[model samples]
Target: MGRRGDYKHFLPLQTRWADNDIYGHVNNVAYYGYFDTVVNEFLISQQVLDIHNGPVIGLVVETGCKYFAPLEFPQKLEGALRVAHIGNSSVRYELAIFKAGDDAPAAEGHFIHVYVDRDARKPVPLPQQFRKVLETILV
Candidate 1:
């Protein structure tokens, strides 16, 4: 809601050549990838999420992005993250893409991840460990 500093965690990202589109700026779709990368990385680092073997997995049900500026190749960027909301089986993550060395965000967005059983794909309450980590960064 304010600046990059407002988020609880940050993950630096290296812009790949392919991230830029013909317009010479990072494509909108690529921004989502950046968002997912940071969220997943944090979960993995905390050992709350296991993509390959965990019984619970998150399924994104909603996502939206707002562009404030263009990002080009070779730019160093950071993905800032915080939890905006947490339901019984879903959590809303707020994210901002900030150009390295800048406090302002180049883009802002939110995505909702509904935790579900990996096998049945039915919504399930978030694990205690998952909820605990999310609480630390809840906005």
Candidate 2:
């Protein structure tokens, strides 16, 4: 598929000193952290997840990444997040890491979260409000 519009939500991420590698570029692994941060921040802001005491929690079932360019430390990143898919208790979160003011993405990836009951750890259907919030971000 072709590229779509930017995500409805954005989370700014500050690159740390330790994030850079010997090559002077941000390590690829750190992108995963950025992805997690952006999505979770959205969930929290939307009040869709309660990390400490919620009855439901999402467990990542799949993930992937694709790098388009290198990133360096001391640079602030704008992580654009959107929902690509929503299934039974599962959602695919698509992320694009962009340098401030740039239209193209430095990195793009997606992760699938299967929601489960906090206690039983069994798959559960997403709540109506939760799905509603995610739907606004669907790409």
Best by TM-score: 1
Instruction: Specify the poorest-scoring 10-residue window by lDDT in model 1.
Output: 1-10
Q: TM-scores for all candidates?
A: 0.98, 0.95
Write the residue-wise lDDT of candidate 2 on 61-133 in tens digits: 8999999889998998899898888998999999989888778889999999999999999999999999999
- Candidate 2 overall Cα lDDT vs. reference? 0.90
lDDT of 1 by residue, 21-137 (tens): 999999999999999999999999999999999999999999999999899999999999999998999999999999997888999999999999999999999888889999999
Ten contiguous residues minimizing lDDT sum, candidate 2: 1-10
Q: Name the regions of candidate 2 deviating beyond 4 angstroms.
A: 1-4
**Candidate 1 CA-lDDT value:** 0.93
